[model samples]
Target: MIKNFLNKLPKKQVKSAESRDGGSLALSSNASTTSRINSASGARSGNVNSLENNSTQNSGVNHGNKLHDPLRSKANGSSPPVPYEALPGFRDVPSAEKQNLFIRKLSMCCVVFDFTDPTKHLNEKDVKRQTLVELVDYVSSANGKFSDVVLQEIVRVVSTNLFRTLSTQPRENKVLEGLDVEEEEPLMDPAWPHLQIVYEFLLRFVTSPETDAKLAKRYVDHSFILRLLDLFDSEDPREREYLKTVLHRIYGKFMVHRPFIRKTINNIFYRFIFETEKHNGIAELLEILGSIINGFALPLKEEHKLFLVRALIPLHKPKCIPMYHQQLTYSITQFVEKDCKLADTVIRGLLKYWPITNSSKEVMFLGELEEVLEATQPPEFQRCMVPLFRQIGRCMSSSHFQVG
Candidate 1:
């Protein structure tokens, strides 16, 4: 019966179900350090040299009429306020002029517009959307490599658009027990039509072989990462899905950012578990973490173990566990698979957070517990067997027949 019920549980759309990894994470290097890298790899690409001195300092942009923000360039105070005509296509410009055109278009895109109210900035908004599509294609097929200035402009444009204050989400009506989003209608970001293009451009920019990580790191620095992390709380799932992929790629490529990224994610999880207990991207984040854990090199680090004990296990305490438990359990199983010695610690942690009042969560917990026990070693089992069965005894007598 437990097997039947567990088998019937809905599976989430986990993109990183397996480890699809590239090179080991590489830490970002400073100027002299980058010079050494340049020399070491015979200076990997022109981009490394192009972006040595770039810095990632972004003062927050001023918001205007939800659809758009104040433009960063001289265009902001222009008498008319909006640009007279759309920037010419990148392809239309001479090769020498394309770079400047790219920067100008980026500056134009920096100003976000209120798409919900199409009555405002109708022409300007259409221009930016077309420009974003052009930028995506341009980044996709740009020849040699991005220059330092170009790299900085790309990050600046991406930051300007993607990292706005998300709309106020509806309050979660905490269910004593259940598995569902609190909101009946998912709150779609009104600007997503434009925001989606920006996200795509960023994704392509990161994944582009031309956008060398060595130089890109200067702009895609820790500050950029924090801003990206904040967007995980976005009410829009589509937005979160794009964020998940971009972050995973960033983590994989920029080795230096891994510890910072993981630690920050832990902090987010801690806040979600302890303070807020609400986040749309928890499952998506766990999906990325699951991939990351799967690719863990042997002799798993103590940091990994601590993450399991601190963030991953206590995650069970949230009423929203069902929202993210599939990814959570997958992540936990990765830890155990990597180091069976952690099985005892995991079993004990599961028992510690075992649902006493929420039978639905209890069922979810039991389902995950079964997965953990399947991989538990005999010696580890002996270590926690007594308390484990003791909890099982309580669960057997659970007033909820299904949980029993």
Candidate 2:
């Protein structure tokens, strides 16, 4: 009766039933299928049964209830399966189907979850987050050899939503003349973590050796780089840090775009200096520009000289001059080193912005002056000596200092 019942069971359920029964029965019509299933299940169940019996017997003797060799079964033949890369041929030309699937998966990862209704979609949100993390991990490990299609897809998704919560443009006045109302709420998204992941992925993308040229030519445009600069004013320190790294990476990898990056930073500095726009990443941006200036060739371009005069020189006028002092000094020194003739120009610029009331700042200015004087050639120094000593004489006679 039991044999008849087992034989009558559907093929799908038969294997499950056989597993439950320790695979003791031979019920299938195909002899090889029945033999293979029986043998495999018997071995699996035998290991499990031995483990259970050993634990039962050793419960009192072992004191910790420890059984022998938990990995013994896996060692024999039941090892955990290996995970395959979802985007194969990522280093070369991926197949059309794989590319399409990768695009679909990437698009799905961009889905924003409504945190206000987390109760309804908690499970779905978790699954999506995990998928995004895994996908980002895979791409980052590729070392920047992504196909052109993949690079475009990544740039499309990242640019649109990188600053989803924050506006790149200045905030507008929402209140009307006489109406009393509550303040407007900030537009924040719950998926900032995912956004951060994508930013990190982009950092890796730009820094990847194979992808640098591709990114510069195909994906990284002037508008996209400008949008990144606009994000420099983000209130969130974390977002600003990520932006700093990403911008630096872009500057490093895309040599062709370095001029534009400097120009954009110069415009931002113009606003911060002249218009007094509050930008938190000025120090960070200067840090990046310092490296770019270091790499400039001799006989600096007129634009490069103007940047040092207009952008970097005025940077010292801000209250937070100390914050960017090191990077600012390095950039100034780079210019002077590149062309000793610029030494007089830099010193004159420094004297123009030299602090008035703050004695400590005056000392800092003097230190920067000494560096320029040290780097200045004798002939160049002689050219500006009269005006340079005139400024020093004024410093000595100023009311803030008392001569010994």
What is candidate 2's lDDT per residue for 1-404, written digit by digit as tens? 22322233224312111111111111122222123223222221232112112122110011111112111011111111222123332334455455566676565544433333323434444444455555555554554367777777677656644634454655433323221223543333333444555665676566556575744467788877887888777644445656765676566556566667777889999998888635667766776666566666556778888988888888888765665677788779878988899988888788788766666667678888888788899988888889888878878886665310
TM-score between candidate 1 and the true structure: 0.80
Off by over 4 Å in 1: 1-80, 176-183
- The clash tally of candidate 1 reads 11
List the global CA lDDT of all models.
Answer: 0.70, 0.57
Cα lDDT tens digits for candidate 1, 1-404: 22222232223222332222221321121123223223322121222222211111111222333223322222232223434367787768789998889888877677655444434455555556667767877786788899999998898888777776777756474554345545444565556656666776887788778988888899899999998999988876667767876787788667778888889999999999999898878987888788778777778777888998999999988887777888899989988987899999999999988877777788888998899989988999999999999999998998888778
Output the number of the TM-score-best candidate.
1
Candidate 2 lowest-lDDT run of ten: 57-66
Q: After the best TM-score superposition of candidate 1, give how far the Cα of residue 279 lies from its true spot, in angstroms.
A: 1.9
